[model samples]
Target chain A: MIILEDVHYTYDGIYTALQGISLQVDDGERLAVIGANGAGKTTMIKHMNGLLRPQEGRVILDGQDTKFMSVAEIAREVGLVFQNPDHQLFLDSVKKEVEFGLRNIGFTENEAEQRRQKTLASLGLEGLAERSPFTLSGGERKRVALASVLSTEPRFLALDEPTIGQDAHQKNRLAQMLAEMNKRGRTVVVVTHDIEFVIENFPRTVAMAEGQIIADGSTNMVLSNDEVIERCSLAPPQMTLAARAIRNVFPEVGQRLTLLSELEETIMGILGGA
Target chain B: MALIEFADFSFKYLGADSLALKRIKLIIDEGEYVVLTGPSGCGKTTFCRAINALVPQFHRGYVAGNVYTDGKNTRENEVATFASVAGLVFQNPENQLVTLDVEKEIAFGPENLGVAPAEIRRRVEELIELLDLEELREKHPHEMSGGEQQRVAIAATLALKPKVLVADEPTSNLDPKSAETILEIFAHLNKRGMAVVLVEHRLDLVARDASRIILMNKGRIVADGNPREILAMDLCEEIGVGVPKATQVYKRLRTRGVDLRNVPLTGVELAELVQEATSQ
Candidate 1:
């Protein structure tokens, strides 16, 4: 489990990135952090892995205070995938990139090699193991970056904008992959601007705006709140909007209806059949 | 003549195993808004590059057929010659921004084309206001957000005053509101008689505004037609293209015998359809 108590951070001693944030994440939890650009979503997640230590409060990872732990030490339990894959990928081949993190964390050569092979195969990247990471497409490189971090088998996996530049098929695959990882006892945290993806996959959401956590609750409740959605500059998922638009006609249709299947079922219920 | 034409065009990279674009035959006329989309690596980018002769000219590829811009064959013309005819905005705004600040970046294109200083200044000011980049005029491109940089990139491309604006996934990196703002700008530009050909995957945001939808897969134009007609087909779903959420619901309702008068492209439209159906 991870807990942040009244955390505060600033850049260059001028611009405040996080202002008194307090949150907690349990083991095997699936959470999403969402807001507009410059909302400090990235800065908030940077605290999870000790990339940016809080200036005023404390972050507790498992049982230890993160302020006392080095970034390398905290990284053992927290794997952070940056918004841009290029920042994390520097090795030549995809195989080397995945093994680099494992080797640096003190894993033996044999263990690192076995984990690397399994990670690559799991992400459907075994076919491109020998290819240069720079030569792959944006989506493929993102998978490679994920493979690199998943190979570490960290307790908490925090991803920043994992769905950018991906098509529907790729996004679907990533959702499934993240679900599988969570089932295997890995906690997943995603920071993204893709509202539709959040509504579909994430069960819990934290909405932020201007260096503050505006709202935190179940994904459906937070997204359905007009104030939170407007304050965060987030567009609600299409089905939710559709349900709200006809609320006068079908007052039973809830505002929290986000999934297409949910809306279809409601309409079918009203229509009295297929 | 059409603004751009690809006649039985097929292209292969210098050492690639297969064709990047195969036997593409299409014409994009002036004042038309076209949305080109498909799965990743589906020749959509190559098609955009071919519009400005960047494929065979800049990338050094084997060309099988002909591409013409404003009645000039691309093979016989320089890439620079088509700059004013077909302005292409890349997917990554960071890569295409040449100048430090937003104002200079917008002015760089027309200056290179030898436009008069006064004329360039006029176009730059017009684009800045048009793209709502007034406050960001002095900010560096690298310091701005992804949405702001994309607005600047679009303004820079518009400074050249091309007949057709070809953008490759301009809003992929933007937040939802910013993406809608960018697409609205493209629609506004198209309303003013500048044809816009945008490459994007978020059909939910753009399917309503685009006049035509061109679907590509494996280097081929699999489907192309009116947005409503094309989106109603199962081809989009089979090819992994993101059919709008409202459209998906409409199709499901149709299969279950809830027939609506039209294919709704957006949530509001879908709700209107549902209201009408339930009222009857």
Candidate 2:
């Protein structure tokens, strides 16, 4: 569980990235931070794992304040998978990258190697053990990054736009992987502008705009509010556009849906002469 | 009226033994949304560069074909003038953007073309509003997100108001929603009659609205059709082109003993199909 209390983050002593961000992410909750390009999403997540300390208030991780914790200590409790895989992955091989974190935390050579193999196999990167990390594609690099974090076995996982720029196949693979990881009871917080991913994957949603938590609730509830969506400079998902059209003509079907996934079924139910 | 025409166009980079493109004959009508896609290094980027004369000029390769743009042969045209009709936004926004501030960045193109100061100012302001970049005007390029920076790069391209805008993996730097906005902007431009070509592997976002889909493979346009038609081909999977969720669902249901060969193209259509099939 994580509790953010009046967290305000400013960089370079001038630009305020996040202002008064307060939220509680319960244990086992898959929370999504939805926003436009620069909606302070990264600033909020950086505070969690001590990448950036809050300039004001407190960021408490399972009752331990982040201010009192070192970044190395934070890494043990929360694994941060950044959008750019190049940042976290420093090893030559896919297998070693996964084991690097384990070895750095002072695990024995055997134990680190054991964790690396297991993590690689579990993520379907078993054959990539001998493969060079540099030779991999964008999607493969991201997977290697996730594999590295998962190997360390952190209690909480935070990702920044994990599916950016990936093809649909890659995106689906990521979605499936994240869903499987979430089902195992790891608290997953993803900061993403990928509306479709949010709609299909995360049941809960939080929208950030101009350094503020503008909306928070179910994915459907938070996304349907056009005022909040526009303020965030974000567009509605494909299904939401269709849902709104149906609502304009017949409000009945619109009331029962929030996500495009749910809307698709609801609309089909209506179209089938329900 | 075709703004760009390719006659059995084939190209191979300098010193390359194999052809990167082969026997490609095509015509892009002005203001059309044509998405060029395939697996990485499959000649998508190579073919895109050919539009703006990068193939033989910047690339210094042997091109054994004719490429005509606006009735002028691409090989014979000046690189600068051909650049005016076709603007290429590269895969990385950070690489494409060369300016410090948002306003100046947008006006960079018009200024380079020697537009009047007042015209440049007007164009920049209009672009800021059009692309919803008002608040970020004074901000530096590095201060923006990957998605914001991509938008800025795109807005700068629009300031030139080129007849054709080709972005090579632009959304590969953005989140899905921002990708959607970018695609929406592409659709808006196509509606306004600006010829557009996007080299993207994310077929789902452009699947519904794109007027034409050209599937490439090893420097060849293997398959060409509308969105649904291209997705329905088994070759799409083999060539590594992604299938939308609807197409995937449709393909799965067919194997699972459901008889919906008519795959829905978009999420909405898929939903409707599922709802109907289940209820019945």
lDDT of each: 0.87, 0.78
lDDT of 1 by residue, A158-262 (tens): 999988777788778788888988999999999998888898889999999989999999997888888988877778778877888867667776656778998
TM-scores for all candidates: the values are 0.93, 0.75
lDDT value, candidate 2, whole model = 0.78
Clashing pairs in 2: A165-B172
Give the lDDT of residue B93 in candidate 1.
81
| Fnat for the candidates in order | 0.59, 0.19
Candidate 1 chain A: 10-residue stretch with minimal lDDT: A265-274
lDDT of 2 at B2: 79
lDDT for A159 in candidate 2 is 89
Model number with the top lDDT: 1
Error of 1 at B37 (Å): 1.5
Q: Is the docking of candidate 2 incorrect, acceptable, medium or high quality?
A: incorrect
lDDT of 1 at B258: 84
Clashes of 2: 1
